[model samples]
Target: MEASDARVVYVHGNGNKVREDLLKSQWDTALFGADMGAATRMAYWAPLRYPAPLSDAGEDPIDGGPGGPVGFEAPDAPAAEPPDAFIARTLAEARLDATLGGAEGLVPSAPGATGDPAEAEAALGEWLRDMTYLGDTLAEGESANTVPGSDAGLEALPLPRAARTAVFRLLVEHTFKDVHGYFFGGAGPAMREVFTRALDAVAVPDGGALVVLSHSLGTIIAYEALRERPRDVDLLVTVGSPLAITEIRDILLQPPAVPAGVAAWCNASDPRDLVALDHTLRPEYAPVELVTDHLVTNDSGNHHGIREYLSTRPVRDPVRAVFDGLASGQTQ
Candidate 1:
């Protein structure tokens, strides 16, 4: 389809705020910015809590990741020890000064930790200030950091400060796994409501196709939400997402509503991502049909971040194909 005729709605991963700037950053710096033309229209959404609720229990043991409603094989290697353990080790290795910043930042000596009460307040203040500083530093006080002059004339310009603040708080608190569930597990019910509400607010104009562009957990949310409400979506895309995870595949087909009418489903992933283990969401559940599966590999070793992939031909080619297919009416 012609780029001008397509509308893309982006649902971001867990612990996220559905804000414009972050969406632009993901597209420009990670997804569509490389050879992919910015001509395609786009928008993004996140969970209700901004940063959704979190669980530190770790990846599902069955899936070798974290626990969820899904099934999985146990992780081959012992799951890496939780960060709290590392904190314990740190406290043992390095003596913490109770009076320095007070007891807040000090690594607690054991589980269900307690700090010196006298210093707790002071330590809490210091930590809060540090967090506030980091938040402002990351975006330079903006809710999201955007790539300048990438794609112009896209609607939803000039992101709101209120939205940014809400998003900032959400992003800061995200535990990563819950972010993954935001797209899966229907994020329970409240998240689904936020998604539909946001999509409605965007209001795709008549005479143009609207595409749903999602990455990581966002892809899962898009797919499940569509299963609930399929009318507005034109195409669905998943990049560096854990939707391919075994747990999710089983849920879609097991005696429940499955994703349908997606028009075209495209999955692009880098091998380096530890979480994007698989891409096929049980081919049986697709309402439309998947086009092509691209095993694009990016240098970003970080499982969730696809910095290099977005700059390469792998991401560009498939996105361009989706655009071409939509513009030409061939994707369906």
Candidate 2:
């Protein structure tokens, strides 16, 4: 079969997103100048997380697309917190313990503690100071210096330090929430079902190439799905994935190895992308030789944006090569 006939299946990451059609179009434009017609498909699972899709006018907080950052209210009811091992581990790796602690301090003091308004005000001030220090430390890359930008690549964002910290906090919260829901909220089977259906929908004929492109939490979904039901995937591309984290790896169907159905696995990440802190999957996954990892600069303000990651050469070229018939078992 010719490479032009190859099919591409995209799996999006966490958080409520725009309508499925719009989301797919945005991704299509970023990866390919124009839609590939029936050659491409998106496994959209946002409806499972949010009751309704965000209006076209609203900005996706996670993506930071158009309209800038928007205020997001916390969930009114406490979400089920089944074993937070993944959340705890991810925060520690990101060095956000202090930032979270400061946020906790912002809450009103206990009933017995301070009746005086003056004292309460003082406590609030102290918490603010601590949070400021923590934010500065993160921005300066003192403790969580994983990315080139001291602020984990958030410094480039136009927002002030406090605002940047809040944005990062929200991002982390939403990211872990979705991940937790997928693993423990009884959403795993359903999410994987969505992926399975999409994969099966691909019209690739016998011997035709098939590529799976997944980002962030989508990477986790793709990995497990491909692992559970082996298929002939010409290439599996993952970006901003948290699969490298030990906690995440531990919970997945063990023993860790490249999905058997995948002929070649290419993982790309920006050094500043906290979600993909580990940056490389070659050493962790089994049959290490088959997994190739590349580091690219994601100019997206947050450095974790899917569009920026998709636009990078390391990512775009490989996918394009598969369609161009230039890619073999491994990406050039």
Candidate 3:
């Protein structure tokens, strides 16, 4: 059960990424501080969403390459919002423009209206309350009053208020686009095929462990793929995942449970990662006793980058232990 015999398969999350080999190399370095060489493989799904790999000239914006923001940035023309009502509701809930009519369904009184002063005052009071609620939601995680299907509202993120809102919007737009594409846009089969092929490509010797590490939207892909086509996975680690979101869980293979072939499941998230707003899987996935959740501080500006998650001790330790034959029960 040496590290060399254990194989790791990584599935990336949403957004355009660098070339496949480079992406794999970056992950290897992040997890182990050196190239794992043949010990690891990546299920590269970015090409399915982005027609081309990000240029090597430091233009990669998804994971904060040289020219991009420290973390993520929305593309020049962000993908149109998907048609899902849940997504629309989340966006409307997070919108900061008060003049617009959608912020908690409160519309500002008409400009310079001669309406009754009492009515106007009541409307203003309601608007102020809604704004305060939005601020509170961001400051403290999701409020108990959050809509049933909505994501955990954005946290008191490190970025400026405006930047945080923009990032949240972008994350939502990209996440739903990718999630919707795989589940509803006929991309599921192809993406799952890529994952299955990657898993198959890794050659694990007898008694050797196979770990599946998935992030963000990739977690959804890995989960569905493994459910449809089970594999003997020693450990399934999901980071910055959206699996707990009600809408996402609803679309997953019914009667959710740990994939039959998976021995242990660990879910990790940064408290500030909007994509992984829910931060736990045990509550939703069955055989809940087998699922473990870990909270790690992701120093990356947006707090959801794969490198940040992978490098965290809480995440990397279990993977290392499994590979080293030291892991028992649930390593996390």
Candidate 4:
């Protein structure tokens, strides 16, 4: 192994309205503090899926590849019923979740998973049995473990089926849209362009020492890009990610569940984060030895917020390790 300059690339999780500057500022503050300037970049794809409102009026997607921020927007498709449906579902859930105050309280996830790896695995096994998908991963006759994070601490009870279904549906919508855009929706090249730029930018004094911080749908893009495009990332951080969720996993480009050039994978989740319904990744990606799961406090009104995860020690420690490696001349 050799040491090289490490660059951080960020992929923002969810939301149509997030601005790149805002995302960059928040990530910079969280991952590197406000003062430290580092080799960090972001792979932005929100403008592809989210259209600006008429009142806010921004440039539309065009042939040179969508308008707005040069690397942001993607070609707009004909007005479809799905967007309308997504809006309706989101609004409906917003009302219901607000009323219940279940957004933060219902899912009392453990602060972190420590001690026996086998013990943590056993606990997740017990919890999944109560969920809709993935019950067979556990071996026959495993013992139940105390629920942690999003999976526990509900001084209250679980959400009703309807509320849960609404949350699930709303989330499922984002994954579906991302997959559609990244593959068939003519947005593939746009995403590839971002990866290309970041990879090139990171090749500073050396050739390719990269770090990717992908959130929500960006995780899907990063995974596919890392697999198909192939680059060197010393550390891969997924914050409030949906990669473990069955909806997205079923659609991954490669079933390896791990990217090709990543030296280490760190998965940080706030169990209370609705989008990260499936917080653990090692179970599905067991062949990989370097995946570290960090269950941290989101500290946001809504547990799934990316800023919250980015600020946690669990997330920063892994990223810092990469920079430390870079400083020591450790190469991937």
Candidate 5:
């Protein structure tokens, strides 16, 4: 696994409250090791939305500190409050706002929830996996997101308002603006800066592989960025991604698209991870030649956690292949 010339760019997803260095260090430790943090590049962009001089007091201010369960630990805390309560508290606390734009797509598509608990429950279960720490901290109640039924497909379930708002504000609002703007709205320099920085981090040697690892909404960002600006990518790994969500596909740079130079697109998601509600991108991405989807089940109660997805065979197998290719000077 001699990767001296190869590079791995990690694009983080939503609700990142820790400092970039800390987040980068944590992810590096999770993905590689203590020393590898410096080797792995982080596309730090949380500050783009929540600029410096950060504060806990504001209508939509980000709260950053060392809190909640770290990594993919199962929740053993008592379920005294409903999942929504913890979500509500997290929403109030996260304050992930869209300063330049407002809400978009699916979040508004189903404003009010439906009575059939089956679909909603299944979706909620998926979302819960992302916020398992909230599951650990809150007291259980009846109204929280608790999805039932077989986890499958691109249907818009009747998710509760609290849960809906939380997802919308944290993941949707935070990412949709940049992505949509970049493709449709003729995004300005800020978005350009993001793409610029992403490309700059690669610095892959002439024959070395470029591995782009993205989590949650970061999948959207990485996909679109690569699609618009075609480049050499040996492996594109998306964990806990929402690329299959019909709403996202609707306004993508190229509807039903894949990046030009990407050798392989490996999408991994837990069936219960609501963020990855759609689960499979093979259908929408069409032909399904280069794309492969994996059902990496999370045993740690919260399946949506990036750490859980990272630990699965889906991520490890392809990643190993890429490194092996780099070592052998061959493209798989």
Candidate 6:
């Protein structure tokens, strides 16, 4: 896919572009003495929101043909309820304040999950299983595989793979679910409305192939988006993606968005980084092709330097594979 042909949507994680101070401070803590300018430039990309009505309850389905799936499914529709309910449950479990913290509580809405709160609640419990550090704790009671910058002696680090993946999951959840209630409350309906509007604004013209290059939490968002709208996605490349986080894989309760279409995914990670430890991006779903890329680098700049790892050989190879896969139409 030509760079211009592909509509590479860079979905940022956790904070907003307008909220630069907060974003910088959070990043500073993670990187630890790293150059702020470089990290910001490499990580910061595009904001995916656009103007739209905040609440669409009883409103006509916003056109998803252009933007994607903001209002793709009908309200009170059976298919739409599961994701919504799931999001509501997630917020409740995290004990988050949905609107204040800018967290996405649910997929469609964080409130009712179509109409089945009980089912949604159950699913939410399963999903939270992967968010905690215990998710990575082995039954055998063995120590976790170490990743660079993962020394608990310093900051009580989470299992590298689980940490990044859980962070990604929560960040994505923040985009849609309300965070305040003990178990479920205000979902980020406005943010979903914005995302739907933005995708509609930048509608992929001519059915040309589009490739999404994501890192860390961005990767999780991309995966969920694909799960919701697989028809719109062509190539998905995740670098330092924590898809393998035990809780994320175990808990999130939605089915594949694109169940039949063949979408290519390229997952790249560094063995020693700890964030992608034992799990980053391993293709488990069908009709979605996965090609693994190892961001082969030492433990020196581990977890915090995902953007830095992009220049290394392992990371580049799978990126090339994505391009190559698009060209050849087959190769893992």
- The TM-score values for the models, in the order shown, are 0.50, 0.68, 0.69, 0.61, 0.63, 0.43
**What is the C-alpha local distance difference test score of candidate 1?**
0.42
Off by over 4 Å in 1: 1-3, 16-19, 25-47, 50-176, 179-187, 252-258, 282-284, 287-291, 306-309, 312-314, 321-332
- Candidate 3: residue pairs that collide: none
TM-score of candidate 6 versus the correct structure, residues matched by position: 0.43
| lDDT scores of the candidates, listed in order | 0.42, 0.64, 0.64, 0.53, 0.55, 0.37
| Residue-level lDDT tens digits of model 2 in 1-332 | 23366888999987788898787877878887776667789999988889999998776656544442222211221222111322333233333333434333222323354334334334433443443333334333222222111122222112223323332443445455688788777898899899999998888866568989999999999999988998989889899887876546767965678888787787876544556645567667877766777666554534467887787766777688777763354344
| Candidates arranged by TM-score, highest first | 3, 2, 5, 4, 1, 6
Distance (Å) between predicted and true CA of 286, model 5? 3.0
For model 3, residues 138-163, the per-residue Cα lDDT tens digits are 33332322111233333222232233
What is the per-residue lDDT of model 5 for residues 16-85, given as tens digits with 9 covering 90 to 100?
Answer: 3356666666666666545354346777666665456223332111111223222122234232334454
Q: Which candidate wins on TM-score?
A: 3
Worst 10 residues of 1 by lDDT: 149-158
- Tens-place lDDT per residue, model 4, 1-332, is 22337677887654454466655766778777763344677676666666752222332221012332211222342212132332333344344323323223323323342423335334433332333122121112222212112221111123333344334444434333454566556776677677667666655556436678887667767777788877767778787776776545655667855666677787776544556666677667644466766556553433455665676766776677666767775533
For every model shown, the clashing-pair count is: 17, 0, 0, 16, 18, 34
**Candidate 6: worst-modelled 10 consecutive residues by lDDT:** 60-69
**Which candidate, 5 or 6, would have the higher TM-score against the true structure?**
5
Off by over 4 Å in 3: 1-3, 57-60, 64-171, 326-332
- Candidate 4, run of 10 with poorest lDDT: 147-156
Q: Go through the candidates in order and give the C-alpha RMSD of each one to the true structure.
A: 16.9, 11.4, 10.7, 13.9, 9.1, 15.7
Candidate 3 vs candidate 4: the lDDT winner is 3
Ordering by lDDT: 3, 2, 5, 4, 1, 6
Could you tell me the lDDT of residue 65 within candidate 2?
Answer: 48
